[model samples]
Target: MTAPTPGTDGPSIRPRTAQHYSVAPVLDTPEGYVAPGMPGVPVTGYDPGTPTPHRRKPRRRTGLALLLAPLAALLAGLAYGCAPLRAADSLGWLTIAQAGLVSLPLGLLGGRNRLLPPLGALLSAGALLLGQLIQQLRLVHADTTTPRTLLQHTLTSWRADLRPLDLAFYAIALTGGFLLTRRTATRT
Candidate 1:
């Protein structure tokens, strides 16, 4: 049906009928939208159910306590190893990988306990050290023993690559892990 325009002299606006519409309307939702007074539904003064209050669903944590620490540590180590592959510069990249990807996420996901934060920090640091070991292993190209030639090269590379700044980054990552883990876990 057509209705007159309110203010201006213009063509009247027409309300759309079902025949004029091309698209099909949604009939039902996943929750099965039901109308009041339908069959078994209460017919007494139709009342729309109060909308549920919006709230963030609490994230599901890994159930096993025994597996949590080792898994976080291993994942942290693997994530650290991946950092070198992503960027040419190892300094800041490794720091971000350890603190951002590994420590922060793993710590938040790890069990909430007073002792867990310190443990997560230590584990993350240990894992990064293991990552350093992985780097040293990568330098050893030959699978078989190289009669001390390759071994010396590996050790030298490891020693030369480690700098005072890298040590500082390591400390930062450990502190970040402890702080982040402790902060989130303590909250309700």
Candidate 2:
């Protein structure tokens, strides 16, 4: 600081040197007051209630999952049919891939836990079971049979044709789809 300087009327003060401080952003202030901003600090436009351009609006996934579940299950069924049913080692990666892939959209589009996992599992089980029945009818009997009779026959004989890892693969697919497809809970 400079000493006081003499003026015509009275002693006048000399200008003091500017003070230096480290640059830091100030967030807290008195009500209705905004603190001084520091240089080189970028400001954000995000507000509590305002929607961001990058954030997609949260939506219900049930409708889309319901629509696509059947299709995905059908594909899995077709793939299952192609595998050697007698000594099948695995359900084939395609079935597992389809199940997991179908679940991705459910996770990405929706928020929080819902019925999607169980619903997908149910659809998949039904299609796979029905596929087994149809395949047995086409290959084993090759005779004209009523739907009810065919279903009953498959029900009785399905256990006989069960492969070593059939249940395990099915379980893996279902579990993978469920766990891998879980959605995050949205606050807004």
Candidate 3:
């Protein structure tokens, strides 16, 4: 084999394959780099271009709460008025405690409305007053005393008949109802 001529092919020499590389686009801004057109993806910092999340409006339940409040107050009042009659005289404190506890639900249920607190308190007071009236009437009927004398005695001695602790219990129930309702209404 003599030396090949310049035009004649001897051993074929192949060229090396070219290498390829790629990189993501980088942006320099105060809000940091954010890919455009991607929804709900938060940028590193504050990006004015980014879409804000949608916020749903709170549901309005004030009307429904107002309607239910009086009914709840009535139930609470009935509970307070009847509890003492059902229990023995020695356990009067138990009745007071029950009345206070029972009234809590009324506050919790109706306190959502602005007017419910006062309404609940008024209903509770009325119930207690009615109970006293009924008790005095019963006493007058049982005794041989005249209605006028019994009424006068009951009215004059009403303060003595009502213990301070019982009043405190009623106050606590009313205040507790108002506070609880107010707190819940603000949160909504």
Compare the candidates by TM-score and give the number of the best one.
Answer: 2
| Model 2, span 1-188: residue lDDT tens | 56556676566666656756697666577776544486654568757798657976567765665666677667667666666767443444444565665565555544455676665555555555655665665564555367777666766676787775667656766766666556322435
TM-score-wise, the better of 1 and 3 is: 1
Model 3 agreement with the true structure over 96-175: per-residue lDDT tens digits: 34334334444444435556556545554555555555554554456547768878776755656778766765575555
C-alpha lDDT score of every prediction, in listed order: 0.61, 0.60, 0.54
Q: How close is candidate 3 to the true structure, as a TM-score?
A: 0.46
Query: Candidate 1 vs candidate 3: which has greater lDDT?
Result: 1
Residue 159 alpha-carbon offset, candidate 2, angstroms: 2.2
88-168 per-residue lDDT for model 1 (tens digits): 245443654554444444446554656666765776677777666566656565553775766677667778888887787
- Number of backbone collisions per candidate, in order? 0, 0, 0
What lDDT would candidate 2 get against the real structure? 0.60
Please report how far candidate 2 places residue 14 from its true position, in Å.
38
